[model samples]
Target: MSQQPKSSDDENQTEMYIRVKRNKTTYFLQCLPSEKVLQIKEKLQVLIDEPVNNQRLILIQTGEVLDDSKSLADQKVENDAAVALTLRKADNEFEDVNVVKPDDYIRDGDGGSNW
Candidate 1:
């Protein structure tokens, strides 16, 4: 009787070591078996000292944003998987109040000052 070959699980459990790069620094993230992508983001937030909402993490191979619902295992993150995290530029950090100074209003083409 011939014995069946060992399953993938039995042969070797694959591990994912995610590396997140921000600015000039790189943070290493070691994920547990079956860990989700969102979890990795959370870990990166702690290491990078940035808000989780402001980060844009993508799979280098697929170019897809890491979805919270998707597991790292499903993403096929192996030991060599290269994950990159970019800090998304914040929109309009300075508010446009449209404050018209009294001097500037007089310089305008509108004859509001004379009226």
Candidate 2:
């Protein structure tokens, strides 16, 4: 039997996940591509005790500053995308992108030799 093609609306409604990173921490968020940036920030607010207004999200791959008024789809943020989360500082300036990779982690042993 042949399967039916998925409609655009169906694709938009499909559950997707994105990784929100900050420093050495990563937050995997379940979201639809149709969700707005502000919505994502609100979700992050729950996990992090930070206000949405103090948070800024940037697409890691494109280095594009995500607009709170725009949808993830509109920003071309697809499934499994990595987004960097930065918070406002005391001076009211957004912090720099500081996503740390696994390679940056320092092991207790020298040269990562377990043998």
Candidate 3:
């Protein structure tokens, strides 16, 4: 009697690929079969310069912000998962405020208004 061949599932397991987009650049993250979303975020922190806690990352498909407490496995992150980094606007109002001193308006050799 001949023996049956093993199924492909038994021979090899497929790995999930996570895609991260930062500053318009796309990064591919190859995760283990059991890796969590938080684990992936940790890896991303190393790749980007921004602080991990302050940085905003969203799921491309759902446009939902990734909760730090959640896991990638829980989110059902699978092959071709697209993750995007959203930059937060600076809170300071002075960022665009320009201050011009009175001296800046003085003309060459022009004295103050003569009475």
Candidate 2 per-residue lDDT, tens place, 24-61, comes to 99999999888999999999999999999999999999
Judged by whole-model lDDT over C-alpha atoms, candidate 3 comes out at 0.63
| Overall local distance difference test of candidate 1 | 0.64
TM-scores of all models?
0.59, 0.84, 0.58
Q: List where candidate 1 sits over 4 angstroms from the true fold.
A: 1-15, 92-115
Rank by lDDT, highest first.
Answer: 2, 1, 3
Candidate 2: 10-residue stretch with minimal lDDT: 106-115
- lDDT (10s digit) by residue, model 3, range 1-115: 9956868643433567877876436778877545656677677778876556546567777877777667665665557877776654576211221223356566766674431
By TM-score, the better pick of 1 and 3 is 1
lDDT by residue (tens digit), candidate 1, 1-115: 9966868664444455776654445667777647777777788778777776766677767766677667776766667566667665557242221223346446567667653
Candidate that scores best on lDDT: 2
Q: Give RMSD (Å) of candidate 1 vs. truth.
A: 16.5
